[model samples]
Target: MSPFYFGWLRWIMVYNSSIRYIDDSLFIDGIDLASIVRQVSTPTYIYSLKRVGENYRRIREAFAPLAAQIHFSVKANGNLAILRSLSRAGAGFDCVSAGEIDRCLRAGAPAQDIVFAGVGKTRAEIAFAVSAGIGWFNVENLAELHYINSSADDLGVDAVKVALRLNPQVTANTHPYMATGHGAAKFGLTADVIRDILTRQSDYPRLSIAGIHIHIGSQLGDTAATLAALDAALDLLAAHPRIRTINLGGGLPVAYRAHDAQPSLGDLVSELIPRLAGYDVLLEPGRSIVADAGLLVAELLYVKRQAGQVFYIIDASMAELIRPALYDAHHEVAPLRKTDREPVVAQVVGPVCESADVLARDRELPALQAGDHVALMTAGAYGMSMASNYNARPRPAEVVVSESGDNWRVSRRRETFDDLAQSDK
Candidate 1:
């Protein structure tokens, strides 16, 4: 391998332990990328089950001192195999919709271990969750509380556990699109509303207001906003002695750049465990656990040179992964096969019709040609979960590699043209 290839390999390996290279071939968990492509074709999502287990165990061990419950966020990657692996490893689930809850149940997660959370929970979703005997509901507003209470009463279920989500009004150091803790965000109730609701707790006789949930946002780079939110929740807990559980929503971040300096999980846990002595703590981690565990592999379709700029067009597009188009997210692209060719500043684009379908802009990648396979690094989270079928393109398949790296299987088969129009009457 040349210096450029070595540098690229070393950079990606820093994010997760499952990615590596063997004899100039990129392998995820010891399974060669070429072998997977030969079996499942390109534009398939390949996940390392080993990495998923490792990430989950890391969080569990870090919060072991507080005996905190770690709930894997389902909105990150809801593939059945992924959820099943986490469930088997003793992970509870954090679901944002009735469909997510159903996915968890199908994946063998117990209903009592799932937490239903969302800004808008419809009456049907609440009724379904209540009937399913869900463990907790992260209530966002007073109207939601009334809905839950009424649903519980109609179902003859009493003392249904509910957590009031508070908007700490502290702006987190993240993208404005993902920020939810600020006062203007439509995620949680303000402090005054929470206080007033607590004072009138007796109004909801069927609901058990036992927890306080505060989630500032995703991809949090610092602890300032989180700590401030924690303080606010703690203050509320102090005033309301009946509230014993503190649900700290997940915002732990994963590094997209090789040199990115993200806070260590242990450091955050150390700052948190001390203040959460008497209360039950819950964490809902999504991206930090899976973002680096998987990759999106695509085959180069054309090499276009337009206006003196190089564009590597791939079979994949915003339909498969939309972070770049949606949030201007950065996901490093690496060639599956190593070469000694000098690196060039090129843009990786998809076949989407929109101009915003660029994946990586001005990235220093080895000169690639048609039929060359490339993998997008740190795409395990928000990739498949946010995918769309724009321009009538079928979505890609998903594969999971076992811990030993010796076994792999297609978890989700690629969609066909017939499958696309199956919903039509």
Candidate 2:
């Protein structure tokens, strides 16, 4: 084994077994980072297939004795390889767009196992979903309901199964941008609005309310808001006993820092599974399944110091991983190699031309130099799925490390400048 150093000058070998250092180099799933960077190149996304499977099994086992169905949220990672792996494990899909449906289909997920959820689905999108014969539509508003019914009628399809997304007004103490079930959030329908829709259900004969859906927010550490939302939905169900499904949308938080005290999936299952008895339940889990299983490896390009403030610039930018810049999200930054130098306060910035391209600020890491490697931890979720070709920069590639870590396959090849210009009309 290599060596491990934590802030102080002391050194030891074998840190976290999942991600360890051997011969002063980081190894993910037993694959050396120095070799991966040399072959796959830096600024690449590396996912541990074993870790993902472990997470999936953990969630499955937690809800096995309960009436729950695991629907992997496609918006979290959306990589085909990842989707295929989950699909093989009997996990359904929770998609938000026509494109996501297509991706899920391409990933070998059946149409009956895919549920589409979104607030602003266009008429065309609704028609596409109808054509695809998706399982259910998590209708957000009356307009969407009407549009979906009209589209189903136009396509000569039978009754379309749907779940009305209810805004329980339960505040999910997460980022405001991600909170969805609040009274003011532009997502789900209010209770009064839901009642109106039920009263007028006969008007849209082509739509059938098959279930109730509620998603409070992402990165939720506590279960209070989710429980409140569920109770609100259950109250509505008392008046309408025909609704058999409850879609507790994905918002299970992940621990971005080592010290974070995020609850386990078992904790959630223990608290909610019993309450959801006697009903067919659906859970849309995104980040909780893949976040901790992935990492973004970047190559340090330059080290700058000015007025006692130090900055370490890397090849990755917001164009590659936007969670930090978009949500002001926190992701642990760590050196890929062991170091004995005293820890220094520094900001880890990326190559994006914008000032908000910072990944982590006021962080401490071993003094790193050019050509060294660092990883953005817990980046498997919103990291690449939210990436863009900002500043005309091509996106990074992705590699899925096999169970043994002895074999790693490139799930996606690095984009070229030509790829960026292909859609330029």
Candidate 3:
């Protein structure tokens, strides 16, 4: 294998073999990804209506028989266009921050359709949620319960709807940063402690117990893990009469690589729907519905050879998408130029000045060259939402293909250098 290869013939080969839909990658359609790289530059997020809609429809159809609702996790991808599209497709908002609530509202989602959640909400955020008449609050602690009650009293609003977030103390078996429901993650109130809350509800007058919410964790790769979490929550819910709505926090996993196996939402429903029987069900699905629906397209800037290893460095980096460095995550890569032969082992990295900035390690990838565009697949979830302006890098633009049509639209304008210093004196 050559240490470096970036010729026109090599480019054409990779382009032809990469995953294609209508001769375009899963997320790139109608709009020229190559042109976007030329005009707006790299490190951009591209969304596919076809792929996103498929995930949404699969979950909806799988859970349709049950009395359930899908609240798109705003923390996953807060793009207004993304939210609006999901909202239009019979989805509601699951917000952890007031900013997310505001984003949902701006996306034209009804206040009655948004559910507020998270551990640390400010007094101002509480008042904002109450004032906007958001559908429900997934309260984390007694202090929050009291604060919400006090805020509702001050606002002179009708009784506030709150769902006690109960922790089953079961391990979600995921990464620590993303796994929240385990013993001491500071997420939900313990299920036993929740028994006391039910006993003392009258102490908080302004708060009305509307439901029970429990989130096991995030990026949960196992369907059995989720079902186990659900059974635990149901056991807790069995004793509470006031609990009408049950929210199972979303951590459904999506396969970034083609061979990884993840259970369909129906598989989860098949096990859970039978258990719940007649209760109102709510799921806060952030990643699984959107992750595989997005792609981060960047052009190769240079190919470097060190010893026997090869490097395909791109214009995108941690400033544009941080999941790789932050979580040691893996995303499938494809060369824009298709090749006839199999792949070669190479390291794909970005221009970021850190050793951990590599996207893929010593992995087999199609030989790529300068001018050849590549995609980081399954980025629709934590990709752009977790992006930062670190190193003062300009963020990428997001283009969305229409669900009902074949045309694409720019959802977010690409960030520029001026954006970095615009607020500085």
| Span of 10 residues, lowest total lDDT, candidate 1 | 7-16
- Per-residue alpha-carbon lDDT of model 2 for 1-425, expressed as tens digits? 22323444433344333566677877888798777888989899999877888888877787786757899998999989899999988889999999999999999998989999998898888999998999999999888888988898999988799999999998998998888888888989999999888878898999888889999999986888899899999988889887889999899888887666546777777778677888888889999899988999999999999878899999998898888888999988878886767677899999888999999999878888999899888899988999899998889999998876687889999999999899889
Clashes of each: 0, 2, 11
Question: Which has the higher TM-score value, candidate number 1 or candidate number 3?
Answer: 1
Which of 2 and 3 is ahead in TM-score?
2
Q: Which rank order by TM-score, best down to worst?
A: 1, 2, 3
Better of 1 and 2 by TM-score: 1
Report the error of model 2 at residue 421, Å.
1.2
lDDT of each: 0.90, 0.86, 0.78
Q: State in Å the error of residue 367, model 2.
A: 1.3
Residues 115-232, candidate 3: write the lDDT tens digits: 9998999989999999999999999988898889888899997678888898777778777778887888788898787888888989888888878888888888667666776777
lDDT for model 3:
0.78
| Runs in model 3 lying further than 4 Å from the true structure | 1-32, 340-342
Model 1: per-residue lDDT, tens digit, 1-425? 56676655554433457887677888897788899999899799999999999999988998899898999999999989999999999999999999999999999999999999999999999999999999999999789999999999999999999999999989999999989999889999888999999899899999988999999999997888999999988887787887889999999989887567645888788888788988899999999889989899999999999999999999999999999998999998878987767777799999999999999999888888899999998899999988888999888999999867789999999999998999999
Q: Which candidate is the best by TM-score?
A: 1
Q: List ranges where model 1 is wrong by over 4 Å.
A: 1-15
List the lowest-lDDT window of 10 residues for candidate 3: 10-19
